[model samples]
Target: MMAGAQRSQTSFHFCHNPHAGSLLQGLQELRSDNLLTDVILCVSGKEIPCHRSVLAACSEYFRAMFCNGLRESKDYKVTIHEVSPDALQLIVDYAYTSEITITEDNAWQLLEGANFFQILPVRDACVTFVSNNFSAKDCLQMMQVGNMLSCPDLEKNASLCALKEFTTVSKTPEFLSLTKDQLITLISSDDLNASEKTVYRAVMTWINHDTRKRKKEMRELMELVRFPFMDKLYFLENVDNNNAVRKSCQDILTETRRYQLFPEEVESPCTRPRRTSGLREAVLVFGGLEKMEIGENPAVFSNSITCSPEPSTSSWTRVSRMKRKNDSRFAVAVLGTRNVIVSCGAKSRDVWLYHPELNSWHKLAQMKENRYHHKLAVVQGKVYAIGGRNLSSESSPWTSVEVYDRIQNKWTESVSLPKSRCGHAVAVVDGNIYVMGGLDTEYKDTSTVYRFSPGDSQWQSQTDMPLTTYAITASVLNGNIYVATLTNFLCYKPCENGGSWSVVVGVGTLCMYGMTVLWWESSHLWWL
Candidate 1:
């Protein structure tokens, strides 16, 4: 009993003290003092004194070397041939202290040594350091190292960084040094910043780096370029003469020409090798009040259309004209990036869908009610038409809502609003439909805000507006809704239950009733 109790007490004492800071301090001091050092690791004939117990605990290689009856276990000396002395020294220090500084100069070397020893944490740290410091100049090398060490995420990040800065990266010697697979990986990224022409030039340079070796890969590679987006003249004059490009992408070039000359006959080929994945979105405005000559008023049925990159940029270019006149009160909503659907054409049940790419309009199925002053918002790619009046019928303003599925090409009924209202603003945020302040059944502006989810049948009331004024337009940005009234702009926080509307400064005041308000990321593109 005494022997058993003594053994338990010793085991408990060791367990309790194993992770204490004092033990780490003692080990650090022991390392500094070179006390009880059990082994010497030689790298390139340079010796680094180390404790075998610390090495064995921290590294699988050292553990196997010390515990498996290896020659180094008896001799207390192991020669490392794969890594340099500097990397070995860093590894030895990390084994004792559990920390090491990884810089650009020594990162690859340390990673190599760490990988060889199966020190996964050290390898991860090296990868992280390289990933964070990636630039056009060093990213290729970083990617190469990451690929060799089996760190896929690090390799991906490094390759993407190089692709984003391809114009500069392509001029470097490292660009030519890229393996065929590595270059393909760079080109396959969604938003590699280089234009199609620059990419073609870069490919030519890479192939020319060693013509005998890289010539075979030329055809297989040129087929990946998005030639349709490139200039037509450049393809005819420059790219057509290339024997490799002509041979590899002959079918693709013919398709590109068919798309250009006979656009309606053929669907555009969509092989974007290096197209910007980040959206290059622009807002298109159609049919509002336009200024006329001094003696005349602007025609009611007139043509005025423009698309701006942002809400603030001065550069606005003319685009296709709306086929039908658009009133300020009519509901408008964008269905994905391709289709812009306009409904409730001022008491008429006409619904027009506009295609931006083709710059053409087609009339879709009409709504159940011939509603004007109605609200429309898109949730999960389906358009929801909510709360408006039917001017043709003598019915009271609509409190009912319906969803239009693009797939079904028809109107489907949804949950009704809590109260009858018109000219209210509706916004879709976090997959919920929020109906805000508008004229109530009594024709008075109501301060109430209600929320509705797709699956739910009831409209749950949310935080009301700070003021009783009707919300003219609303747009969501970063999960927060910005509600604009006739007099002021208010920001609504949906997460906060009570009195979430806070006054936004510097917006000044709205004199006229604004038709629509949208929230774009870059403020520079916003003109109105």
Candidate 2:
């Protein structure tokens, strides 16, 4: 008796359940033969025969209607609103077979029906299909559908696609069909990825598409552009000379003129540079020591500068040189105003601002302490100079930190680092400053990482890096910090598992000291 009871407890299990598919097939065949289906779905004057139990098992909509004591629970025929007949048929087939084909023509209709029927798998699949196949032609329509369906991921992807291809998308009739608020929202983004001239042309095109209806929206639309960043010739010929622009945007034009004439004095959105303007991503080589010959002889520190709009082609153009000669190892950062700020790295207290449009440099108030081999980072529009050594204190690095004051044109003392170090790398992510691997107070390479919030009085220590090396460089992309060390490339995720480090790639023979790494679009790193 005991052996029989034990044998009965040992039950067989089937992970694949070979009969499940056949069971569904049999149910589908029965419904096809009009044998056992108890419910009929009516849509657009057409009827779809389905089993109530099968429908209820797959869809919360049908389950609630049939099992929640609703009137439809007792009825054999139910009318489905909003969903078309073809869409209803597809949904019923999916409920029985657990699979359905999604084509370009039927994707939208299926998505709407699935959303209405609370069929999450089908809805998610439709969203994925639309997002993966998004193009400039259908991005606007997808964005509208996403918004109506309350799918944020789909909406965000579509918006990004439209922005990336704005030059081509703006010429489409769909762009003209956008409402005023929608147009404003699209044009106001800094990530539009189009030149100011192109944006201005697109705005003009939209207004001209319907002159009487959109003429009153001209000023509001034009205000979204960064006019000061436009080319002087384009502004004169296309904008200043346009009678319509003159009539609707006189005050904006005057402000733009002031911004052009006296840029340092003007402080407005018009003066702020767009990401697609002259301030677009480019490789800027600052003043550094360059060898005159190929041999390992003494090199001379020069104030010359160079830039490359596209680094992959290796095409470099000489830009305006720095005013101060023999300036090397300085910290360079782009400010919120889109101007490059260079702090002297040659044991001097001088700071300079470079204007890309004018191709000129202007002097700013100097720092109180001299710094070299330090790092500069911009956080929330303020510049912070991190640790480095000075000539007077050659034995020890400076622990003092300074924040640049643009208004006063001077540097003010801020919270200092816990330990003095030099040759460190600094990066900003989500408004917080991250200082990574550098030499510590012992003048030894350390992998310690420190984080500082502007509102905090002191810096907090996070997870250390994998490699311990100085003369490192770091940059932020997509909310993560990428560090380039002498021998390896590393990525630090601050929000993951209380700050974790991962090795992205090994530098191997490509390793070098005093290198700077910048992250741009196209997933390419510009190394200098």
Identify the candidate with maximal lDDT.
Answer: 2
- TM-score for candidate 1, please give it: 0.52
Q: Where does candidate 1 have its weakest 10-residue lDDT segment? A: 264-273
lDDT of each: 0.75, 0.83
Candidate 1: residue 157 lDDT (0-100) = 82
lDDT (10s digit) by residue, model 2, range 321-364: 88777766688887755589888877688888898878978898
For model 1, what is the error of residue 233's alpha carbon versus the real structure, in angstroms, after optimal superposition? 2.8
User: So what's the TM-score on candidate 2?
Assistant: 0.56
Cα-based RMSD of the predictions, in order? 15.3, 10.3
Judging by TM-score against the true structure, name the best candidate.
Answer: 2
Residue 42, model 2: lDDT of 85
* Model 2 residue 470 lDDT score: 84
Q: What TM-score fits each model?
A: 0.52, 0.56
Q: Give lDDT for model 2.
A: 0.83
